[model samples]
Target: MAAGQHFFGPWDYVVLVIVLLISASIGVYYRFTGGKQKTMQEYLLADKNMSIIPVAFSLMASFMSAITLLGVSSENYTFGIQFIVINISYGIFTPVAAYLYLPVFFKLQATSAYEYLERRFGKASRLAASLSYTLQMTLYMGVVLYAPALALEALTGISKVAAILSVGLVCTFYSTIGGMKAVLITDVFQSLLMFAAVFSVIIYAVIDKGSFDEIWNIAERGNRTDLLNFNPDPTERHSWFSLIIGGGITFLSLYAVNQTQVQRYLTVKDLKRAQTALWLNWPILTCLSLSTSFSGLAIYSKYAACDPVKAKVINSPDQLMPLYVVDTMGDIPGLSGLFVAGIFSASLSTVSAAVNSLAAVTIEDYYKPLYKSIFGKSLSEKTIAIQSKLIALLFGLLCLAVAFLAQFLGGVLQASLTIFGVVGGPLLALFTLGMFTTTANEKGSLFGLLCGISFALWMAFGNPKPPLPALPVTTEGCSSVFTNVTVVAEPQLTRATTQQQEYFWLYKVSYLYNGVFGLLSTYIIGYVASLVINKIKGVSTQNLDPHLFITPIARRLERTMDIPLNTKELSDSQEELNGKYEVNGKY
Candidate 1:
């Protein structure tokens, strides 16, 4: 086979088309057969009738996108196994999401998670959180949609624009028509396909390489198996501190407050079932993460001696997995197509979820209030449902526009995580203030959100120098060598001198800590600001509801202060007793 050529056969194309058809068919089936989505609840929450297994699978599908499938392999191939710490961090935080945050939203029966913000703080706080989520998910959807297309164009010799358009259009069709049901049902199918694709690559790589021991031996020798780096340096990219502490905060932002996961949590029948679904996601997420990490190790084993980067077979680490798929599985007919379909499945599930969530936030948080205030009337259910579909369509187009520009970003995993940290951090802080503390007023929450965003942006893009490119590797084991190929040397860095130390200390923080920094900054600043305001105005915190705090914290405060914390229950009973007294007086 010649270099720079793809080997997709006619059968492969047929298989790809079949995958696309099945996704579209599910949408059509739901549109005609499923009952009409007459209200926001039915349209966005699947009528709150979703079962545990499908919701669990849908949650996994939403969280693990094409970025995880391709980027995780590439990350492991380049940086080693330290990325696995994310799974450990998730294990610790998923339950926090279930018990700490889920009950509040569930008890409130929230359509948008930001609705809780409105009740606890004010409308301004709610709008800030809602808009922040919209921006974050919009940016993320573009990368998710672009990743597979970028890989496909590199491996299959197809047009990048064509791949992006097809993915965006098909996802939009289903999500807009069938609503949440289509997204959920299709997600279950896609999740299974994703597992199959990853398993196939690992199984084939092991068979072709002779044994698992041999693969492990090759990776260990190549320095791809190193796991723990306990270095305490904040600027080091993948240290234990960075991955565990930084990653724990990052996952909290993702699972606890992000609209996508919250929407999934709201779909189940009851709080018990929702909690069960949250716990069930753990094993599935673990399986997927391990599969991708091992697949990366397998790739390293296959190309250990003849690095594709040095051979000029692939341009970037992200392209390595696609090159492997086409070169190794292309001859297997439909197998190559199934793998590509799996990549598309990952992309579609993520983008569709984003579109649906974006639409829900825009209508519920932004549009409904603005429209009512201006017109002095609420929108009918039919009109609101139609508007929601149109909003989904608009967001799909916006995602495509952003996809074209995503090529300029760094690696998929880095870009996605950075966006989550910088955007999601502030939003999570707002929700934390509302749920965890009663003294945080609307002014404090809004101030904290703004400051958190500003600080995160400065930390992320404050430095002027561009990042150094990754160092090159070797291809000494290949059968044939081409002349006139030169490997680029790694760039050297100079120590900072007194004259060069102009930037602030915070500017030097790693991207991994963006979430931690953002969360702490927002909370601290907001709390301090609230204290100052209370001192100046002589405002009292006595009327603030204690139930808004975490249950244990609220209970402890009640016992210490000798105050009643069951305000809602007490108020109901007091009203009933007053009616009895009035009746006795009348007699």
Candidate 2:
């Protein structure tokens, strides 16, 4: 585990080069063979004709970044299988997204998910949601880029900055040129690569570590297999309630409101296919989580005697998977390269999806409207398509710049969930209020969104004090026969802090609950404010647009209040409403 001790050899370099070159070549292929991306729809949505399988795989690729691959294993190694609660959360929420959220966007034929905000509320609401999403993705992309770069730097002795730039440039190239089509195509390949790379490690670990019983014995004895913790404490990081409820809210924010995911849903040609694609993601993601979690146990079994952290072989838990791969697979030539390539694949897929979605939102939500207002004319399809490419390039560079900042952040899993809670939570709340209720008005939503964001930020970053670090564990169970050399332990220093261990009440809330708090805060505030405004202004709820609410909500209101819910009339009215906004270039 010394510096450059298990660096990639020549064949490994060949494998890595092949993976990068194939990704770039996909971009070239789409640029030349797919014809010109003359319209925003073509560039951003792949003309909405994408098939179910590729889109499903692309969703998997986007969802399972290097952080999931590396961080999940690290988590299992450190905390046991309780992290599987996240997958359970996904299982519960993906259907909610498909049934409740997907139809609204699909029915509107909206280019941007935030566009529905404009149609339902006003331009200000749309801008608020879109800006929040753009910021979230931009920040998350940095962590996505940084994770693989850090891993590769350890595995192949490549400079971390170089690894980040290589991924950034390649993803940007294909994504800018080929747009969503190339991104999805490459994602399919990357997903397969990820499966291969992970399974190879698992297969090798099984062979090296003996039968499943032995590995399970080692892991169970080390307290790595505990799956269910029903602790009800809100402050506890991983509990059944936190993981189920908090994790459900977190996943809902991603699958329902996040632009990266919505963009994938919009790529398909029909609602049925889109729903099918979403269903496909569950099993794929579940398998991946189980595989990596098992890999963690295998890693624990392999290193049962000599704890790398205690031995000073690695600085953090995130580095454990890479260390294990290098130690176990170093003699297998191109295997290390494939593993690095797999990490890069995960990073590239996630970043490319972010870049493409960011560009789409920039044009559809911001640029197109501004250009029309100032110039008093719409830009041609060709010009808009070109602008989209430039926007992708710009955002890709921005991601690289911010990636340098991620090195100072905490573990990848916690950092990413915190970002989701801080940004995605408020965004999800705004959309939920708009889509589920007819009473929420523009002024109310705007106020609620601002307040939600401020509160979430306080919860995420208001604490100035760091928690005490846990004590390191010994590797006494690891067989002495594996290592005969005497290893010296370095003295560890502890810091005693007399500063009062006080924190703002909000700061003590687990990051897992940020989304639920933000969602409820925004909706309740917005709904109440709208009721007051309606009472003062004497506005009639009966006269409001029914399409502003979800189908079930609208139907329930019709039953309860005897309000006539005319489906055809509502469809026509919504079409006309969006048409009016589109004509003004404010859609």
Candidate 3:
């Protein structure tokens, strides 16, 4: 690897430091001024008075970060235009979350969405989900820090280990001190920079090549023909069926039930704003995914034929995006700075969000319950926040520690993503079954979640090299990176491919599929266990009230289902509902 003198220019460092100081300054001001909000409602939901536009965009921006920026783009670089199809998941599944889970969550108006699992199924179900979510989120938060750190590590000579502390510390400061208001508001700025970084890469890519069409032709040559094959083959990796069904379930679980996302929905001033935010998130994410993918395409056009891997500096496709920036645009004073701005932008917003949300969950779900159990139901927000911040610090340190786990392994983006999905699969099912089906009682929910998680570990990461089938890649005219470059896996391109191959069977299990598997098992096992537990524990599925689970649209469709909608009795939950809500109406 060729190494050179590396430094961020004075102007660039100034911009970076100024960004950090500005965020910290706002944190200090808000800590005193608008920071009077110390109640659980204030900390977790922002007093539920946030304007719709910023709230919705915050949700979009928070959800869309370096993870998606690097993730989908890397997928595209490695997989081709095939990765573009994730938009289908974001577009359809997000609104599905709005309709399916939002109705119950809003109706219950619980601070933590997992609270419903306890109320509806039982405490065991909630514990199962909460513990799993904490695990999922901790690892996820680590990646949030870890991913952008990869970008900075490649850019600056700083070790990946040190980059994490720098990123984690600043984010922890804002998130711990500023709370959700700080997180959502600052996220707006981060989102803007996030787009700037992506679009800047695009602009630089276009400037170097002249026109989009010219770049497309160059990129098309490096494309894999099989990448675009969208057959519903059971064994194919990332097939259309897997992308839609598997991706849909994962999105549904993650967006609908996860406290991190639910916490964002609470920031909306009213349900109306929540609804608006929910509706807006789909297309915004869809567009963001496409933009990142194009950024990868840009990287491919410049280096795919040369097969930069052949050059040895960038052995993996994931590194190609960052390397392209350094090689092509780094000479400009802040171009490297701009990319880092984008990187930190993406990392900082999400990391702060994680810290705040984790604090919320710890206080409400875990700490509060323990407090009540140990003493009584009366714990002040001040006490909870202090405990929560301490948890946040510990959580931050744990995430920082986990970030190093990936460094030992080679830079493989898909492996990281799939590892997350495999573990998260079971948790997704617990929430899905709790909200979707009345038959899944507490016992069933717990059993199903455990079963689903156990199975996922066995399937996705159980074996070394994973006996799963490989997707095809087009490399007919591909030059060996130095001829010493090892050929590991075949590639695939989208439709209009120049080559073809049979789909592999074992690949029926993509990471996304884990969500479906978990959701299904939770339902199936939940019902069976309900009977056994009902006998032993004297439980009652008989009282599984349809009213608790129905949606606004379901009210309109109730006539056909024989479930009567009483407008008068809706008053019981009305006081909980704000006049500003986003629902169609509770029947």
Candidate 4:
């Protein structure tokens, strides 16, 4: 309970060191083996030869980092378990990602996802979307890098600077040297530790209390078990409607179109394998999400009467899990270290993914174009291979610097999701406009993306907003347990009673709806603007590329071409359609 007192024992440090060493060694192994990352494809996309299982695990680990581990548990402890309903939206949208959007990227097979935007719209559209993506990932990874620092500072009694530096340096080292191959394999190994960490809390809670049923019952009595809310109001925080509809949009925005996951999907052999990996990721993701949510209840059952935050044992709700581990399980030696290692692994997986993907975007989307514009030629493969590693290293350090600013952001879960929604929604709308409809053009889509981001940012942080009220907590039991420490009196919960009509209506809406607002704003405005521009300019749509659209739309458009086809011509077309469409004169 004193400052500078180390929570980890000797064995704890040993376990933690071994975990970090093993992670770094995986990168080393991949760097020295086969192809040796001599080409850009091998370095960035894993040479398109990865197995399905590792890719699936990597996909889950990349986004569901320590942010989920720390934030979701705190979310359930403070608000309730209603956040678990978002998993249902994941299942509902997995097919959309697998069948619809996955095919477009798979068929194109470009290193950067923004390259699809370039071919579909134009150079201007691609630049706009890619820069938005770069900003989004940088902000999200900054929050991710800050997560482990909280764990370290809480358990080890050290400054956050040490934690952030250790994680950033090691993650950047392995991901930079090992390339995509190392990232995927390390993610698989780290995914196991993530599961171990969450399970440790549940197992300890059962031992500390009597049984799982008692934990659930205690949580129910504490008013944290309410799950069913069908409210249709968009302003409601965690209702079935918000979780299902709004959460589904967020899911599509990330899993369907975001570059981090899309790059993972591209590492596999072909479209079928990629789709299989996408389907497999849902159950793995859902399992971790449900366990993490329950772990919150597991911690809450112990502090139901004597809240740690109320007792001033922890500074914030995010510190509750680490403090609980040190209080109840510190004597178990390696258990506490394993939990911290899991949190570290979560941050490593996410930050590494962002680092690699950001580098890829920079090379293909930004660097290549600038090089061509100034020099009138493409760079050699050797230069690309060398520069990709440097770009990855630079971006990792940039994200590390950004982590210092994450203290200004509030909760880890909301901050990460808010980033996804604010930027990801408009990007998803841009891709959807290109693939699903035939009317959207370059100028309109660029305008729509910029406006959508502006609107979402305003909704998320435009005005000073009230804090979300937590369930009732008390220090009645803490008074008997800690005689020397001062337990703060249970203050009145007044924020919930404040007049809702006082704040701006957009600010009053739930953070979950930010993506939905962005998607609607972009798609509706982009489509209408495109129609207006086409009418005024008298532009014709007769020569658009069929491959730019999805399969059904592309096939229908092929049938509507100007030249009439005989039976033999139709037969030839059927055979070509059965295989793949030509893009830029080659598949």
Q: Per-residue alpha-carbon lDDT of model 4 for 1-587, expressed as tens digits?
A: 43224478888889998998888788788888946988988988988899999999998998997988899999999999999999999999999899889887877777899888877787788889889999999998889888888998888876889888988888777667878888999999999999988888999999888899999999999999999888888878889999988889999998989988999999998789999999999999999999999999999987887887777776778877887788778888898888899999778878888889999999999999899999999999999988988998998899899999988778888888888889988889999999998888888877888889899999998886756868898778775544355765556768876546477778878899999999999999999888888788876666555666777787777687653223234334644542453322233
- Pairs of residues at least 3 apart in sequence or in different chains that clash in candidate 2: 304-478, 305-478
**Candidate 4 least-lDDT 10 residues:** 578-587
* Candidate 2: residue 256 lDDT (0-100): 79
**Candidates, ranked, TM-score:** 4, 2, 1, 3
Q: Per-residue lDDT for 1-587 in model 3, tens only?
A: 13233446776677777776765665566566664557767766777777766666677776557777666666666666676676687777777778677766766677777887776666666776777777877777777777777777667757777888888776666676776776677777777777887887789879988988877876677553234567776455677778777777667766777788888887765455677788887777777778888887787666665555544455355556666677676677867776777778667777777777777777777888888999977687788767777787777777777777755433344544555566556776676666565456665668877887777666655434333332233333345422334445546766867555443333335666665666666567766776666567764444343445646434544444443445344446454333322221111
Off by over 4 Å in 4: 1-6, 479-484, 490-501, 561-587
Best by TM-score: 4
Tens digit of per-residue lDDT, candidate 1, span 170-229: 777766786787788989988988998888889989999899888888888877777768
TM-score of each: 0.91, 0.92, 0.86, 0.94
Q: Using TM-score as the measure, name the better of candidate 1 and candidate 3.
A: 1
lDDT (Cα, tens digit) per residue for candidate 2, span 122-190: 888899889999898888888888888778877877787898888777766666776788788888888
- For model 1, the superposed segments whose C-alpha errors exceed 4 Å read 465-472, 480-508, 554-587
How many residue pairs in model 4 have overlapping backbones?
0
